[model samples]
Target: MTEHATRHTPPEGPPGDGDVLLVTDLSRRFGDLIAVDGVSFRVGRGETYGLLGPNGAGKTTTISMVAGLIEADAGTVTVKGHRMGPARVEPKRHIGLVPQELAIYPELTARENLTFFGRLQGMSGTTLASRVEDVLDVIGLSDRAKDPTKEFSGGMKRRLNIGIGLLHEPELLILDEPTVGVDPQSRNSILESVESLSTAGMAVLYTTHYMEEAERLCDRIGIIDSGLLQAEGTRDELIRLTGDVDHIRLDGSGDTVAAEAALLALPAVEQVDRERHTLHLAVHDAPTAIAEIVTEATSAGMRLNDVQITRPNLESVFLRLTGKALRD
Candidate 1:
């Protein structure tokens, strides 16, 4: 939401100074089909970089390579200046990955789950104890830490899954759809926790199907389709590429032909369509031009009944680029 980056892959050199994650010309294959084709992006310190795509879009595959959970058939993944791979242990310490599926035990309490994962990452004694409590607070689950995960709400358990990933406080955190099936209130809490993490200076690589989440949480976003990184930039920057214009519609009575003639002469109006008593207009800067458009139509002898405007957002851009809705 604050900082931004468009460096999909930096120039060949030591991984772009402060870049926490650098993926360049990354590719992968599953038998004959290409699952990931030349995808690249970077996540800088304190930056929340969102990767958005529908199912079977190579999002999860890319995350797996970045986390070194799997090997890349081609290209490279560097984390905190070290090369990353499944066999590479050192660089793995700087990365924390929270998968889409719930990675917790229903029999264990929140605190127990944190302590267990913390110990797996080599923490013990007071350090693990302190971190478990801290994470419980960060996830807004402090009061419910002792309840079995099965007793927790869907959102609560999801938060605990995120807390497990946060236990080590790695420099780069990769979250894959952390709010998939949770209730709205719980989803908001998870979002708030992520915001706080970004503010505290942790780099995050996020992937989601929600446009609002990307617009709200990410400093920059990368849209992937058919195993390719289609575009990357800040929300406003990407929207500008859509070349999408706002619309103004007018429903009225009286001289429709005269109003159509007058509306065409307006500088802001791009095109107009008329069907019976209503005129549908394609216009730029609708907010600033609506008043002028309404006056012109009324002056042309059309008595106005109602007016409406539709503006473009991230979803519009997504639809334009991918030829499908984000959820589709």
Candidate 2:
């Protein structure tokens, strides 16, 4: 690729002000299947850009190209102003990738593992040692720094995996589904670490199938499905793309038909559907409509089990656009 097609020089100053990563019209295909179809997005320094999609939604394929592991059939990927390719060491040097799969050595102590990876990136002597210590503290494994990784809990190992990526102090950190199978506590810990990294001025590209994760961490999100980028924006912007109102789910043991009819009659309610004992309502204003809905249900002789008012969010927006949940 030509230098003009790949590199972009920022205006100058602190990171996150100008775009740190720019991907334009990137496309990749495997025989008959187009895994990533003309995908494009940007990540500013210190900002987290989430690629949200379900399994088999091309999120992995997209990131593989960005990471320079796979070449794109079309378009360009520029990292901090340098084009990404197998031979482009400078651009790759600016990226720190923590893949979905664990990349640490189970038999090595945490310190040893960090030192080895740091040395691979050309770090040495006091600098590598200090960087390893810093990474150990950052990943919350300072106390367990001497323990063999095999003895660590799943969460600790995952954290160590992340630390390995940070050893080189790359400008961009790409975390691909960092919390896949860990317990809730570990998941929260991982999210907190990511937040801290972004706060410290590291640009992050986070990919996940979890709606809550995306909502919690991403400054902006790009929703991809079936190899296509369906939508891209902030949480509120994506919700607006759905063109639907708020949602309320009522769980009760009552006359179901009457409850649906009553809620549908309310001006604030736009649509109503039933699934088992739950009444799903699409409404203009959930806060305003919920009280009336509860009143209607109680009047219908239904014993209240639960009442939930859900605002338009990433999940709802995904459902509206793709007719499937983020998990599906």
TM-score of each: 0.85, 0.79
RMSD of each: 4.5, 6.7
Model 2's number of clashes is 1
lDDT of 1 by residue, 91-140 (tens): 88898889999999999998888998899888899988998899898888
Per-residue lDDT of model 2, residues 1-328, tens digit only: 1221122222233324478888887889999999987777889988999999999999999888899998899978889888997667888888998999988899999999999989888899999999999989988899999999999989898989889988998889999999998899989989998999899999999999999999999999998888777888888777766676888888887688888887788888889998878888888768777788788878876677988887878888888777888888
**lDDT of predicted model 1:** 0.88
Residue 185, model 1: Cα distance from true site in angstroms: 1.7
Worst 10 residues of 1 by lDDT: 1-10
The CA lDDT at 171 in model 2 is 88
> What C-alpha lDDT do the candidate models reach, one value each?
0.88, 0.85
In terms of TM-score, the best-performing candidate is 1
User: In model 2, where do residues sit more than 4 Å from their true spots?
Assistant: 1-17, 247-308
